[model samples]
Structure formats: C-alpha cells, structure tokens
Target: MKSVTRSLRVLEAVAQHQPVTVGELTKLFGLPKSTVQRTLVTLAEAGWLRANRKDTTRWEIGARVLAVRPAALQGSSLFAAAREPMIRLRDQVNETIHLSVPDALHSMVVVDRVDCAHAVRTFHAIGDTSPLHATATGHAVLAHLAKSELDEFTAGTLKEYGEETITDPGELRAELRRVKDRGYAVNHNQYLQGVCAIAAPVLDGDGVPLAAVAASLPESRFASGLLPELGRMVTDTAAEITARHPR
Candidate 1:
C-alpha cells in the first residue's frame, strides 16, 4: 500500500513536471534516489511512464497513462443504467457489446461492456481506446460531431491499424456522413482484420451523443447476410440505453 501511494505520487509529480530526470524528481518529492528510480522503472513497465532511451535517466508520461485516466466516474449510475441494455444486445446478437465514451484527444475509453459465450469472442479491456477511423463505436461518436470538430480531429496524421483503416481525410469524412445518414455505423476489417462491428450513438437529454454502443463479432459469424439484422440490434440497443439513461 505504501509503495502504491508512492507510485501514484511519482506519477502526479511527473505529470506536473515533464521531461524531468530521476535525480530531480527524487529531490522534488523528498524521496530517496533508489526509491524514485525503482518507482520510475515500475511505472515505465506498466506503461505509466516512458523512459528516455538516449538519457536512460529521464522519464515522461507514457501513452497508456494518458489513455487510462483514473476512474473519475467510478460507481456512477451511467454504467448501471447501460448494463442491462448492453447484456440484452449481446444476447440478441450473440456478439460482444460495449459502451465507450470519448477521452482526451482522439481516444475512446470503454466504460461498460458485455460479452457473449460464443466459441470466438472479442476481447477488449475496459479502458482501451479503439482507433477513431477504424472502429464502429468510435466512428458513431465521431460522426455526430459538428463539422469543425471533425475537421480538427482529422487534421493531423492518421494511423492505419489495418489495411482498411481510412487514413485519408476526404474518405473518412464521407464515411462519417454515411454513418449520419444511416443513423448507425459499421466497420469491416478496419481496426482488426477478421473482426466486424456495428454501432449507434447514445444521446443525452439534450439530444447530444454522449457515448456509443457497439456489437462486435468475427466476420465469419456475420458473413451470412446478417449485417442488416446486426445493425438493427445495435441501433435498437443504443436507443434503449439513451431512453433509459439521459447521460
């Protein structure tokens, strides 16, 4: 417990002061040099901090730390509200169902999820970020954003997680528009090959998209002309969540 507190303290310090060396952090935190070094090493291993390869003594906040924020909404009613709907979607479609909310800068953080008992299941961690342009959940949320927001989000370079990832801005814009027109989204071997997912937006009381709910299954299971039915199931589940829980 003491060590865990120290680790969090180290992270807080690093987050406050970036590009600082271990010696400097030790002095600032008033901890021993050995203790600080060990903490830095452990944090880097767990993806909380990234060590400087050139200096080997300096550390910076890692991507994972930024990706997985401490659960600020822990024990919130949002998860409880979405639980039954997500389970019903999973059971109806016999696929993995998930709800993800937007996190910092182009990251979608998983808040709640339900999985099917099929021989093949889609495994996703609670706080994992699905690529924005390649995932149905991320696409559904992004599609509802205003034009300016979408432009800013896609202005920078895009990463291609799979062959079907939309790296071009024009192509991605077209896809988002299609999602808006259809009132749902679909991704086929985009983020991960052999995986397919369909999703819809969950709106708040103000009619703004607060989160996205998705059903994911392997392409083999969905290849038999079941796309329309799967999409309807996802859309209906999202609507149910939106109606039951107003953000």
Candidate 2:
C-alpha cells in the first residue's frame, strides 16, 4: 500500500505541474531519482501520464485524467438536469437532443445526449468534440462570449468541415450577432449534411453561458416553414434549464 500511496502522490504532483521531468519530480517530492523514475514509469503505464511528444524527457497527464477529474463528473450532471426536459423536447419535436460544454480549448465537447426513437435519428457520441463555428451549440455559446474572447477564438484560421461551413470570419461574426439578437442559433447542414440543429445557451448562476442545449433532426423531418417553431423549442428548453440553475 505504501507504493500505491507514493504513486498517487506522484500523480497528484504531476497533475499539478505537468510536463515535469524526472529530476523535477524528484526535487518537488524530495524523493530519490530512482524512486521517482519507477513511480513515473508505473503511472505512465497505467495511463495516468503521457510522455511529451516534443520532449520525450518530460511527462504530462494523459487524456484519461479527464475521465477521473471531479469537473468531468460534475459536467455529467448537466445531463441529469436535462434528462426530463430532453425527453419532453424529443417527444414534442421527434428529434435528438444534445448537451455540450466548452472543452480545454476551441472545441465544444459533447457531454451528454439522447437520440430519437426513429431509425434515422441523428446520433453523436458523448465526449466527442464539435467544431465551434459549424455546430448550432457552438454558435449559441460563442454569440454570448465577450468581444475580446471571441476575437481571440476567431483569430486563427478555421477548418472547412462541410461546403456549408462558414469559412469567412466576418460572415461568422455577423451570424453570431444575429444569434445574439435572437437568443438562438441554427445550423442548416453546416456540420453534417442532411441534419439541421437549433441551439440556445444554458446560462450559469450569474447568467453566463455554462453550456448549450440543442435539438437536431434530419432536414427531411422538419420543413423550412417550421424553422421559427423549431428555434422557439430550443430557446424555451434552454431557458427552462437556466432557471433551474442555482444563482
């Protein structure tokens, strides 16, 4: 059990200051070089740490660390909050419901989702990253960000996922402006062809965007004339979720 305790301590140390070398870990923990080396090797083999690609001499926490963290677990609660609402919305609109939150960087991570009962329902895996510009959820959240933050995100070149994906930053900015005014976002075959999504921001305790709630369906299922009603369903569902959040 002593080795296990030492291993956990080493993991905690690495997690706190990643990309650490053997010497740094030894110095930080006041352990011998051999002890730190053995512990690090064991932790790395267990999928807790990953050797840096650029500098193989150093190690950082692995993606598996994301699964064990408290924040990731807490994020799953967003699904719990949306379960009944999602079911209700899915039944009402006969569409799939997706719940997503911002990940470490530019991507929006899908935390939870429910698929429609139909065979042709839209399907997405949990923990998958969606493009911020091409997804309905992404637009809803980005539309609410501060100008400085939004500028920083859009400064880099964006990849074109589909023909309908917005490559022009200026046009995207205008679309975000429209989303801000309407309090909802729409993706018409922007990310995936044949699918359309409507999204709205789920606010935090202080009314900041915490996540986004979206309803996605095959274009064939919803007619163009029903766009306004579809937008309203997403916006109203997100509002219901925000009201449940404790301020």
Candidate 3:
C-alpha cells in the first residue's frame, strides 16, 4: 500500500515538473536514488510517464494521462473559445488548424484541431507533442515568453529534428525576435519533412502567451506568394481567439 502511495506521489510530481530528471525527483522526495528510479519505472510502465525524447534521462507526462482525462483537452474554456475560430481559419486557408499549449518549457502539446476538407491535409492528434524550436506553434509561444524564461529556455540544448531545425542558440534567438516583431512564426519542414506551418501566439490580457494557433499544410501547398496572406489570416484568427478566451 505504501509503495502504491509513493508511486502516485511520484506520478503527480512528474506531471507538475515534467521533463524532470530522476536525480531531481529523488532530491525533491528525499528518497534513495534506487527507490525513486523504481517508482519512476513503475509509473512509466503503467503509461503515466515517458522519458523526454531529446534527453532520455528526464521524464514527462505520457499520452495515457491525456487519454484518461480527455475532457482536459476538449472541455476547457480555451478549447471552447478556439473551436469556432479554428474552424474559420481552416475554412479560410483550407488547411489543418491546430491549437497547442506549451508543456512547461520543453514542448507544445496539441489540444485541439480543426481538419480541412482536403485529403492531403496535415494532421496532429490531440495529444501530439512537438519541440519548441522545431515548430511554428512552439516558436510563437517562445517568442512571447518573458525574458528570464526565454533565457532559461535558450540555455537548454536545442535538439535538431531535421536540417531546417534551428539548432544554433544565436540563430534561434534571432528567429524568435523576428517572430515577436512580426506577430507570427513560420516553419518549413523543420520538425517533419514535407510539412509547413504558420502560427501566431494567443496572448492573455497581460501579454503572456496562453497558447498558439497554427495553420498546418503540406509543403506542396505552401507557396511563397501565399505566405503573406496566410500569415495575416492566421494572426487575425489567433487574435480573435485571444479576445474570446477569458483571461
């Protein structure tokens, strides 16, 4: 019984401080390293946690958690506010529209999606996660982060997803600055080859980013001439979502 209780506590801790190292968990719980590791392994085996993709030693919440609490993704006020706007954006661009929220400072998790009519449209499951430096949604959120938070995020390793991924710290910083100035971010086969996206941050009343709204489509459909128009449409939809969402 005590072991089960400990495992539950460890699971809660992992959810709160995701992408956390086992050593950090041990220190937080004041437990033996072996004991904490065992607890983590148990939770992971039970589908409550999974190791970070970039750093295997660190753990984050797993898909099963989302599967169990489906309402947390679709029943929230953010989803309610974003639904109509997302549908409108998809209709305007004829591309898949995604609403994603940051999972701590590591990754962005897709919370909702409005699919386009085209058979060749992009798709991301509700719980799909993507690196912050490798997707337009992630970059939009990163561009709105507070300076200290941005500094801390930039200090971490930027894992490369593909050749287009910005692995250099300086380059990423520059790109984020550009995103901040332009009110949106764009990705060209950065995270997934043959995929393209444009996104804008949904900011709260205080200007803190709450989520990002992105238009995702195939590379074949992402023409240079259409980028400006797509960017404007996406940013406008994101702004509408921000207005509709309660701060």
Q: How far is 217's C-alpha from truth in model 2 (Å)?
A: 1.5
**Model 2 stretches astray by more than 4 angstroms:** 1-77
TM-score of candidate 1 versus the correct structure, residues matched by position: 0.73
Give per-residue CA lDDT, model 1, range 87-112, as digits (tens): 88877877888889876446777877
Ranking by TM-score: 3, 1, 2
Q: Write the per-residue lDDT of candidate 2 for residues 1-247, one digit (tens) a residue.
A: 9999999889877865778899998889898999999988888888899899999999888877866654654566565577678778888887899888876347787777878888888888766678898999999999988888889888988789789999899989999999989989999889988988899999887666889999988878867788788889889899888876655
**What local lDDT score does residue 32 receive in model 1, on the 0 to 100 scale?**
88
lDDT sort, best first: 3, 2, 1
Q: By TM-score, who's the top model here? A: 3
Per-model C-alpha lDDT, please? 0.82, 0.84, 0.91
**TM match of model 2 to true structure:** 0.71
Can you write out model 3's per-residue Cα lDDT over 78-178, one digit (the tens) per residue? 88899999998888888999999998997898888889999888989876789999999999999999999989999999988889999998999999999
Q: What residue runs in model 3 are displaced by over 4 Å at the alpha carbon?
A: 1-68
Identify the runs in model 1 with alpha carbons over 4 angstroms from their true place. Answer: 1-74
Cα lDDT, model 2, residue 58: 94
